[model samples]
Target: MKEFASIDIGTSYTRVLMGRMGDDGVIQINGAGVSPSQGVRNGGVVNIEQTVQSIQTAAREAELMSGLVVEEAVVNITGKHLKGENSRGVVAVTNRDRVVTESDVLRVIEGAQNIRIPADQEILHVLSREFVVDDQSGIRDPIGMTGVRLESEVHIVTAGKTALTNLRKAVNAAGIRVTNLVMSSLASSEAVLTSGEKDLGVAVVDIGSGVTDIIVYVDGGVFSSATLPWGGSHVTQDLSFGLKIPMEAAELVKRNSGCVQIAAVDPIEKIELPAMSGRPPRWVLRQEIAAIMEPRMREIFELVDQELMRSGKKNALSGGVVITGGGSRVEGAASLAEEVFSMAVRKGNPLPLGGFFDRVDGPEFATSVGLLIGAAQSTDTARKAPRESGSGWMQKLRSWVSENL
Candidate 1:
């Protein structure tokens, strides 16, 4: 068995999960913890001391529960500073029989990486979208194929250098070495999406407290990804302003009674509003609260739709959209998303796990669980003989860049 740990540092909360993959191929979760986040905003660390404290609080809780000490963890990263673009490269086959070999695939991906990158940013992920052998496109595995040329299309994700430096510093200060920094949306997808959805083309939207992340997949690979600067926190702020209530009270009410579609709420059901500084408590219909949440949620979905259209994958999403993260728990979120995107929508939760993980089967735990799964898979891959090229080579290239660049 190989033990692994994952941390999801969000704007509103920090989550830690510890698990192990047994020889039976089952991932058993042993410990978990969640702590209110401080000194973090929009998924970026603003105050190192407070962020460190939050990480320590969450990690310590998980360690105590699992009875294991955590020395390293796979951490998640998200922010407005993330950017992605698509590029393609082609190379001549060099094998004696003119067959596309692993070396040719690696050279092609290296050629694709020759694009110009910004001075203040570093590449975080180089994802293989598709492979083409000669004039045959959409070829997933091109090795051993009789072709004179090999081609690849890849999507590159980049992050600002300062943002990465600050995140690493915060994690190190929390007394844990950062094993890997996975994109928040990518992690969530691993927990929620199935192979069928990816092959048919799907979009995964993770709406956290301060940022909304998007990942689009087509033909079982990543096509595009992006992050918006607004999320559930903005909804709470809107309610606080519109309802004349404190922010804390607004957040509580939103969690308890909020719905994005007024139609889903009963007409006569009412909720009590907490008393403000100078006013007595009042009872308001649930529909009234939905009125405040509907517009904002609709706007968020519209922005996500716009992003999908911008990626040129809007019409190609036959599998539709899957929404996860804490914000997805809000009542009527799926209905609102379906209305805004004019397509099918569903709420996403982490895939089932064994051991002491019943408390973490919700959408809010998707990123952390996915990070754990990713870490275990990466470790398994590292233990095996390295692949000569293709997606495996792309993964190896990313690992190298993540550690060196």
Candidate 2:
């Protein structure tokens, strides 16, 4: 049995997912484990030992549940150091018939990677945005088309080498091998965004604990991505300060009764705070908690809006926004996002894929599930030889689904 696995090293938590790819191309969750994270801040490893221990604990629980060891797995990468930009590559068709072929497509994509980048960073992904054949534009796939000149436009995601090296050290120290490092937002998009949403235009906002990852899709391609340094942890801090409670108790209250919009929460509903530091337990209206959370969440969405506007694609998001991750689990996040962006919004959770979906169904597990999906497909594709058929780039595209995800 081929075991497909994924590890999401989140800020507040670490998740290890164990699954198997069935013959039907769907993933079956064999087991999943979650553990509180340490030595990680904003999805980047700071303390290698602490991160290693956390990965080990989560992998053990997942292995015990599935009876499959996670020797290697696709892991997620995130942090402020990740950046995405659009680039263009043009090349001449090398075929005798002048037909765009898989080789030509590959060369064109390779040409797109020539952009100048900082020496400390390297490209992680080169997602094709569109293609052009001769004078014709907006081609999704150029293979088999007769054109002397072929062009490719792509979104290149780059990550700081130091950040990646530390992440690898932590994961390697945990007694497992890292198969691939996928961007957090791209992985989530694999699980949440529908193809329709991608073509029509949409933005996925993954509001994690220490950071919020944003990715914009237009015309069925990624146009931009950005990471904000603030996330749900800020809200917890606010609750801790305003309610005069400990961080732990504030977190509990925030999860149990927190809502971002005051109107979404009942003013009459009261929260009984756990006594901390010998202070008596105090009762406060839920609205007060929402009041504190609202401004911060609003600020986050506003920042996301600013990012969208900066991308020059703000007017293109007709499909609106899909919010996910831990921060998004807070009540009224979508509502607040819609108000801030003046567009339709919805909470994004993992789509129904296969058996044991119930175990990893929430928005928070989107990255794990997505990584599993890509891993399963990778195994299947690796077993087959690239087709020499006239369909040209189609077979390569099938392989790309797994590799690029």
Candidate 2 clashes between residue pairs 3 or more apart in a chain or in different chains: none
Scanning candidate 2 in windows of ten residues, the lowest lDDT window is 389-398
TM-score, per-candidate, Cα-based: 0.96, 0.95
Q: State each model's CA lDDT, in order.
A: 0.90, 0.88
Highest-lDDT candidate: 1
Per-residue lDDT for 78 in model 2? Answer: 95
Candidate 2 TM-score versus the reference? 0.95
Off by over 4 Å in 2: 388-405
What's the lDDT of the predicted structure labeled candidate 2? 0.88
lDDT of 1 by residue, 13-91 (tens): 9999998877678788888989999999998999999999999999999999999987899999999999989999989
* RMSD for each of the candidates: 1.8, 2.4
Runs of candidate 1 exceeding 4 Å displacement? 275-279, 388-398
Instruction: Tell me the lDDT of candidate 1.
Output: 0.90
Please provide the root mean square deviation of candidate 1 (C-alpha atoms, Å): 1.8
